[model samples]
Target: MFYGKYYLLFFISCSPFCLLGQKAVGIGTSNPRVTLEVAGDAITRDGIEIGVIDDMVDADTSTFLVQEDASNKLKTLDVSNPTGTALGYIQEYIIENPNEDWVLNLDTNISATEFVVNTISAYYNRELDIDGYATVPNFSAYIQDGTWRLTADFPSANNLYDNEIGTWTITTLIYSRDLSKQLGTITIPMNNGSEGSHANPIID
Candidate 1:
């Protein structure tokens, strides 16, 4: 009867685990429809990593993580207009006179409705010369005709005979209105040189 008693003790010890295996486990709810369910927020110390662990080592700022509606699985959602938002730089934009405006044709496929543009960086500086300096130029960007356009305005200056040279570079960022997605970036570089009759001429 000693052997029989030991076997009964063993069965009693294993009974709870066997029942747990077949039933759903609920942390904050009495009734759980899934294998594991939490009624409230759950926190993980190590962080939740989706997709293949090895493949997820690298992180992309342009992509976001979202749960798929059909599969109910987490996946990486890439920016929709990767190629459509690409912008080419202008090799040479000339500004022959002061207070003159130049239109820079941006080579891009960004749509007005899908994304908005903002100037993240705008910088202009005239060449270091004695008694010859130019004020900071104005800049504006917009999307039109299935592309982008940049307008540069050089304020009027009395020093027309002053020989000044420098460069202006503007970096623009394109993203969704909600700011959830980053479409792309554009950098425009303008080389300026003005001497004699020309007010503020851009060579390159």
Candidate 2:
């Protein structure tokens, strides 16, 4: 009868590919394996699938940038020590460092939990169109029984067209952390290369 209906149409077209046999190809595949690892050699067995490590969210803690003391007049000192303990002074430190605007006379506002800072002392007057010079000084302090004795002297480049002045005195030895309440500021950096208006001095 037509060779048993051609063997029942080749067993119903192979019975849906033998009922989907021998699967497991790759990543939930239907014979989809572009390379799930299958080297050579007959007897080989290897399986290592490690991928799913997602759990990290913690990073936010970095903020401490202080530098904004452009002078607002808060230099006070009224004295009182030897247990009667007292602190408050800045009398004056006005050179806002505007490239060394020159003019600072702070003789006393003493405060030292410890002391020793004097490396700034200057005097200038030699002109010839100014050629080379530099200066940078900043300091402000106040705390539990304040204390400081710093020094510095710098500023000199007189030659090349007159008006070359200098004066730098930076000394430090400030201390006061017993009761905790510290406040200090200092930053000096001056590089001169003649061009007009180069005067620095007066930090008594």
Residues 1-204 of candidate 1 have per-residue lDDT tens digits of 999999999999998878798788888999999777998756577976655444443453455666657866655555554554333222233334322233345444656666666655555454322235555556767777856565654554323335544344667676654444543544444456343353444443
User: TM-score for every candidate vs. truth?
Assistant: 0.37, 0.20
lDDT of each: 0.56, 0.39
Clashing pairs in 1: 127-165
> How far out, in Å, is residue 42 in model 1?
17
Give the runs in model 1 whose Cα sits over 4 Å from its true position.
1-63, 67-73, 77-107, 125-136, 157-166, 177-204
Question: How many residue pairs clash in each candidate at the backbone level?
Answer: 1, 55
Model 2 global lDDT (CA atoms, 0 to 1): 0.39
The TM-score obtained by model 1 is: 0.37
lDDT of 2 at 57: 50
- Where model 2 places Cα greater than 4 Å from the true spot, the runs are 1-88, 93-111, 114-130, 133-147, 155-175, 181-204
Tell how far residue 94 is off in model 2, in angstroms: 8.9
What tens-digit string does per-residue lDDT give for candidate 2 at 97-201? 222323334434553443322323332322223345564333333233354432322335223433334333333333234323444544444546444432543
Which candidate number would show the highest TM-score if scored against the true structure?
Answer: 1
